[model samples]
Target: MTEMATIMDCPPPGWEPLVEELARRVSPATVIHCHEPLAKRTTLRVGGPAEVYVEPASEADLAEVVKFVAERAVDLFVLGRGSNLLVRDGGIRGVVICLAHPSFSMVEITGERMRCGAGAKLKLVAVEAKRAGLSGVEFLEGIPGSVGGALRMNAGAMGAWSFAVVESVRIMDYAGRIHERPVAEVPVEYRACPLLKNHIALGAVFKCNATTREEVAQRMNSFSVKRWDSQPAAPSAGCSFKNPATIPAGRLVQELGLKGHRVGGAMVSLEHGNFIVNDGCATAKDVLDLMTLIQARAKTERGIELHPEVEIVGVD
Candidate 1:
């Protein structure tokens, strides 16, 4: 009897064929590559790679690719500006879709509302709002992410959150069905939007108030100054943990004497205890280890259960 072929001998479906097929089905979309480096894509700059990467040219193209991947039961992750994400060292398993195409970065202001694609930079949105003499979104000036990420995470800074200015949102589900829903229908909370967690945010309509351009700029500048003073300049995935209801995460870590603490190449930022910065050569494991240490210490010593605000993805 012939020996049975080993799993390696009969390898699973290769990503190349699927990527090719996706490109064919979704015209104008660019299939980047398999094993694409993820470190450079994330703010932390300390991840492995993506098995498949795609950049859709338009919302329609993104929907087509999403539907294709979903139909094949392949895992999909929609990448934003990667400001608050930590990908593991072993890398992601399936397709990683990035909506950073020019077609998805359009921002238009009409009356008191601004309609923007999800790929638009949060800073760009804030600038556009200021240019139009709009207020309310000035807090977004310091957020280092895109609209899609801001929507998904309800991203906030300087006491203002994304949902505060959000009027409506357009999302494409895993099945490639697009839905536009008013803010009332979307459940947004502290650093989370559960309803849209698995959905791809296509665009959003934001409501702003009429204000003097100077006033808007002043507010933006204030937030920028505050951020620059508090956050570290090193590569990091924003805040490492959420602020517990009782006290801010940074203060808590500082009180625990964890600031400047190091685990391998990852260190608790001396500038901001809530952040873990990668010192040029940190690995994902190093960061995870540091996080574990911080959590353990906080829970054991301070009786505080720290929760991570940064999204940790991929595998070990």
Candidate 2:
């Protein structure tokens, strides 16, 4: 089949055309995998295929791809490590852009300030911070997502959150224009951020403080131990629900005697009441059903509404 025909035939509006246009404008080496498996890319090991999944070789290449999609009004989803996401079984509609390649993962440390790309893993960031004698990011060692994902979700643990250490963030709008803004510009609260709908985070600079390497490492280890005792790191998203300010969500679930609640193949982790696990042979419907049940039970029984921590994507 001709390349253009393969990319264009029966694809979503503007999706195939944009792909073909990108193939012409960008170098062949810069674009990888016109179509890729979503299940393999996500930590959950669930989800259907994506029509076009591009791994841009460099920042310029990534920008170009974003611009093309923006101009054409094509649907696009930016993914970074895919740790706290639940992709539906029917698959995504348009393009899924992944920024996990080394070109998007460069890191720099200078005294109390650290600059890292959006694709850098939070765990790796913690380790690097320790080597650089930085302390604020030590709590990030237990986070399982990328820097971009962390910023998007305002991921927090051990009394520290990504936004708390963030001095400024580099962002790229759909038009490919890059801009930097201080943390105050982005409203953050309870694992939520008011990031622009069309802007994707490129990287961030964090104003951390100097500390002894031994001290930072020690804190990271202690935080890890604490997390292991509280969360089910076996195979699940870090937390399933946002803790209400008045009380912890896990504690509430436990109080309701719903620690091991199950719906189909999906079950709330016995280890942590807030986490829902696939157990084995779980379907997307099973997960959705279980979440619905939990939310209902929490409201009807406890007079509290539990908010989901994980982002649900794709069609049912």
Candidate whose TM-score is highest? 1
* The candidate that achieves the highest lDDT relative to the unseen native structure: 1
Cα RMSD for predicted model 1: 5.7
User: Deviation in angstroms for 210 in model 1?
Assistant: 1.0
lDDT of 2 by residue, 1-316 (tens): 3232123234444555566777665555565455476766766666676777777767777888888777776679988888898788887777778888787797799879989999999888988999988989988898888998888888888788889999999998887789999988888877866684468888999899997999998998999899888777555665778888788888888888888888777778888888887776677677778888888988998788888888888876
- Look at candidate 1 and give me any clashing residue pairs: none
Q: What overall lDDT goes with each candidate model?
A: 0.88, 0.79
Lowest-scoring 10 consecutive residues by lDDT in candidate 2?
A: 1-10
Q: Assess every candidate by TM-score.
A: 0.94, 0.91
- Alpha carbon RMSD to native, model 2: 3.0
Candidate 1 lDDT, tens digit per residue, 1-316? Answer: 3321111111125755566566567654344566778999999999888887778877777888888887899999989999999999988888888999888898999999999999999999999999999999998987889999999999987778999989999999888889999999998878999987788999899999999999999988988899999889999999999999999999999999999999999999999999999999999999999999999999999899999999999989
For candidate 2, give the lDDT of residue 16: 53
